[model samples]
Target chain A: MTVHALKRFDNVTELAPQALVPADTSRGLSITAQGLEKSFGDNRVLRGLDFHVPAGQFVAIVGRSGCGKSTLLRLLLNLDQASGGQFWFGERNDAKPDKSAVRVMFQEPRLLPWASVLSNVEVGLGDKRGTPEGRALALDALRNVGLETRRDDWPAVLSGGQKQRVALARALVSNPRVLAFDEPLGALDALTRISMQKLLGQVWVDQGFTAIMVTHDVAEAVTLADRVLIIEEGEIAMDLSVDLPRPRERGSVEVAQLEGRILRELFRNSKAGEDA
Target chain B: MSAPAEKFSNLTQWILPIGILVVWQVLSSIGFIPGRVLPAPTDVILAGWKVLLNGELAKNIWVSFWRALVGFAIGGGIGFALGLANGLSRRSERFLDSTLQMIRNVPHLALIPLVILWFGIDETAKIFLVALGVFFPIYINTQHGIRTVDAQLVEMGQTYGMTRGALFWRVYLPGALPSIFVGLRYALGIMWLTLIVAETIAASSGIGYMAMQAREFLLVDIVVLSILIYALLGKLADSTARLLERLCLGWHPAFQKR
Candidate 1:
């Protein structure tokens, strides 16, 4: 089937708009990319990539700098145009997915510094921002992130970790089907990063949305993700299933083995490129 | 902070200005300063009283005040509109920026002779000059603010389903506010500066005209009064801007300073 140069999963969903998306068995949505491609001039960032992320699955993508991990997330998040091929969500792909059901949590809190914490969370509701229900939902999301008391405070006053938590609430307030995180904790200190990792994991468990996180930290990738996909030269070099229990001890034997495996693949590719 | 501490801090601000006033008054009264060339502070006060009795002082103040405000609205209104347009849309910038930049390079006050020739010694000339003086600061700062709104924030807003209009309201406008306020304060300073020049050069009314008139009669007290009035008005405008900044940018650390 012929596809447009830029496509967002605008097709009709097999299930109803509000039905379970890969979380409840009766209804499910999936992100399917078939030989998806992207390039900027002579530089090919993603070359014929393919993957299917089923509903409620937490997938972490890690790669060296410029490995197109971010590029893949951008394409999925509808932030950039794909050079060729197609990717879409839901059981059938024709029209794009519900726009409100997709969101991206950037590395920066991107919280409107001018807005209060609750108002920032309400930003995720889009048109519903002015509604009372939207306000209540935002407050609830803030509570889930343990920031209900700071709802009235400006985002500037909150510590860095707290700000990221507000950002997380903003992502979750809409009950989105797909949450794409672009290294949301990349700027955080080590201890703060660990706490944020826990919050991110708990959010996924409770929300049940499909999550795609791009990170440089292999340990974080192994700890939080159900599946870890390592990209090299714009292709998935390894797709390793974590197959571990929730709250998996960080740096445990199982986690370390998976981390090492993914790192070796990435390192081997970089060394090969250097030689060439 | 406690109320006394707050009051003490407030008093600290007045110390230098009050001290200067007291010293100047003592010097003038003691004959260390000549009354003709430089009037005593008391004489300046008496001149203010004389103007108050005749009510010309109010009329002149009103004229100058009105001129500044009207000019600000016209030049600044257009500037703000263009700034947002040019800042948000590259095509608009491409179409209009070079021309505006060329116009901006010409010092606005330098257009005085041409402005007077075009509009005569009327209110139009003064207001036009004032408007021209105030436009560039607002335009340049507002455009800079909008252009520099974090691209990441804009992208996040888009993914969250903000419409084009929503993006401006929720992201671009708030993001650009700090810089816009910077422009507003600067424009206010220029508004007074421009009005002073225009009124002093050619006007039958306004504080500047009164000052120019006093020079002929050597009523140095009224001249000093006019200069003092300009300082007070400038301070008033600045405080108002600061108050607004505090209200809007309470989230900012700089604005929240005690």
Candidate 2:
């Protein structure tokens, strides 16, 4: 599939209702990427990618490893800049200071081993510089994640699931506009993954933060996402919406159908890459 | 069952030292060891008490302790600064790390001949020697601690919008403290060892000099007493370090588990 040239959308007003706004103007960040291009030396990672998740939407991005799922997530968070194309948060362009309102959780529960579980979450508070406000905010965040009891406990003592829960607590405590997950539950066992998925879905619903999760699991994409955007060859291959109601079931016919469609697209994408 | 196991281990710990003392005391009582070469523990204790009462032993001990303290402060300060510089900057590390490593390989003691020549066998040479001895272990450990910090934590810090300075102070320093502490403990050992050696040479005062004098006079009891003093001081310094490590790194997972 040929990568279309990245179109730089000059102003937020030019796009449709769901077009991403520069966070400054919209007072919210609903991520939108259009013709996003990324390459590592000679290897193009993301090619002319485009998608939009309205505010408070739970979007799951699914693709095989090396299919640029993580690259896209990183792009949205500004952890990395795309080589070409325009990505917007809310309705504004990329230059706004409002980008601080975004946060991310990685697959590894990257809690500071030397810090207590509470302090790890409080890292999202970003620089107490010895302030009472920082401590209060950190405590509030720990309480939100239901980990206030383990606040004083070191992260090393936490079980794997508990560690991830602490990480989730950390992400939420910041009260970010957008929470991006880069395969957060990919490392978990089947049972833990299911519970975490349920917990995540409930948290997203309650918090009302626009969340974009990158996953390779078809069922996870179907069960959690409001829309599952499948990437093939570094470009979005399918942009299918999941109209399934809240408290989604993994075995629901709609979920199974969506999962099957994603799996088929994944296989086809792999073959296409192999042929290339 | 567990209580017996605990008692057995505790017994095992003390057995060797107790056994050695018993055998040594028996041999001394039997007169199998000459007093010129070997002194009984009781004789050594009596000699220690005599020196203490005369105030000479206390003065010597104080002199050596102060020297080690001053030297440790100076060398450790410079080592920490240089290590942080090299650790943080790849260019600085590439330029200086090899040279530092090479200098580290040259035993600080080997420089004593030149050091004495330069400083004329006074307090300066001993202090400089102690400083040099303490520098390497602290520097190497500090560098390792900083360099080996988890990259993921750094990235997390960045994502949270932490300033570069905040990143270093909060994430980097705490992460590096354990390795740095290890270096400090090792450096402390080197400080005492170097001070003793420095005091051994050309010193009118201090423990090593007094021990040398005792050896010359064939005062075996004083010699044994001085050696015991060195061991005790070393042990004291080590315990202090361990205590500090526990305090500073108490939030660490290892301590939390305990």
Candidate 3:
């Protein structure tokens, strides 16, 4: 379950030089973390961890429940302060993480039930600051997600997949440099989930925003991520790069092999815990 | 759920009330129930017609309507403001909620004598009484609503960099509205009850006063007519609140018929 074991894969890709350059000159903030640690009282959730996500790179973090994968995402999101660490955004070594530059789509759509579909997307722009121009942007974002037809519908009326699509639209409407997905597709049906994964991949590729997805679904990570980080305990267990090209086929030999490897890593840690 | 079954169910709803009215009317017409005890439907309608012709009923209805409206505005407005203050701020809740809770416990009716002493039998006393009665439900419901807004949604709002005012308007207020409407509906019922009790106890004009005046003369028809008027007014208030709830909370799952 070490980085050395992950190096066995022949298809493992190295960071491309172009990815290091910001994809969108006006947006796309790169992330760097050094000895990141988070604790609630004495129980440390994320013990000292280091990683770098190049601008616009799609990285997925996979782990068993309570392995601090989500905590790491939250720290990167600045939703919670890290107990100890140096986390910076962009190329600058001292750039403080900006809230406006980062947006997160949660396990639930989290659309305001009181707002219309269009208004819900407009919420991504942050409150009353959403002018007519913002509304047009929101509409365009919905169009990107293929939910423009449901612009006036209530969230309650939307199906689970549709709700997640709306949430995706909301997340992208602000044109955030970084988009964090906290198991956003975990709740969808099998068919719906696959379609959504494709939609998400297409959107991410087109927008060229840095994506950090945390998921229990190892296969999903392999299918969508440019690189997959398997977290064991509070640290990164395996940081395997997926050299596979875009529009990855489901149940392909390579994807299945990567999925098996990640699952094995995940199960080994749990088995070790049980032994303890 | 089918169309024919839905039609049947709708029809069945009116059957019981119509049946009761028929039985009551038959019994009263036969004189089995004395007119002195309870007037028949015909007698009540006749008395209502008499009042209508003289414009007495319109005058009394106007007087009562204004009192309820003015009192509700004062009480409901204060309740809503205080609810928001306490709901949104821990400091305000700690300072004000206990005092309000203590005041809420004393039956608003019990303060009628004190209110009369302070404001006399003028419109002020009745309005004050109604205001007192209507405040508690609105305040309590508003607080509960705001406190129970989905934590996840609030966190989402914060992550989106919404300002305090924006969060309150976009998240807190809409989340609290359904509960606030529940309080308003409850307050409307209490508003009428308080006005009825106040008018009956001491008042120069209103439906309650007309009923009281009728009772002394043993005019059962007029008394019955007044009670019906009170029922109609209560229904009117409730329907108005419900309509407002429908308009404001169209996005609410419960209100989404389809």
Candidate 2 docks with a DockQ of 0.58
Computed on C-alpha atoms, the DockQ of candidate 1 is 0.82
Q: Please tell me which model should have the higher lDDT, number 1 or number 2.
A: 1
Specify the CAPRI tier of model 1. high
The digit string of per-residue lDDT tens for model 1 on B1-258 reads 899999999899889999999999999989999998789999999999999899999999999999999999999998899999999999999999999999999988888889989999998999898888889999999999999999988988888888999899989998999999999999999999999988998899999999999998988999999999999999999999988988998988777655
Error of 3 at B258 (Å): 3.1
Please write out the lDDT profile of model 2 over residues B1-258, one tens digit for every residue: 488987897689679878998899889989998767788888988999999999998999999999999999999999999999998999999999999989989988999889978998888999999999999999999999999999999988888888889889888999999999999999999999999888887687899999999888888898888888898899899989988999999877665423
Off by over 4 Å in 3: A1-27, A96-99, A127-130, A272-276, B1-19
| Residue pairs whose backbone atoms clash in candidate 2 | A20-A90, A20-A91, A21-A90, A21-A91, A21-A92, A22-A91, A22-A92
From the highest lDDT down, the ranking of the candidates is 3, 1, 2
Best by TM-score: 1
In the order shown, the chain A TM-scores of the predictions are 0.88, 0.84, 0.87
Global Cα lDDT for candidate 3: 0.85
Ranked candidates, highest DockQ first: 1, 3, 2
Compared with the real two-chain complex, what DockQ does model 3 have?
A: 0.78
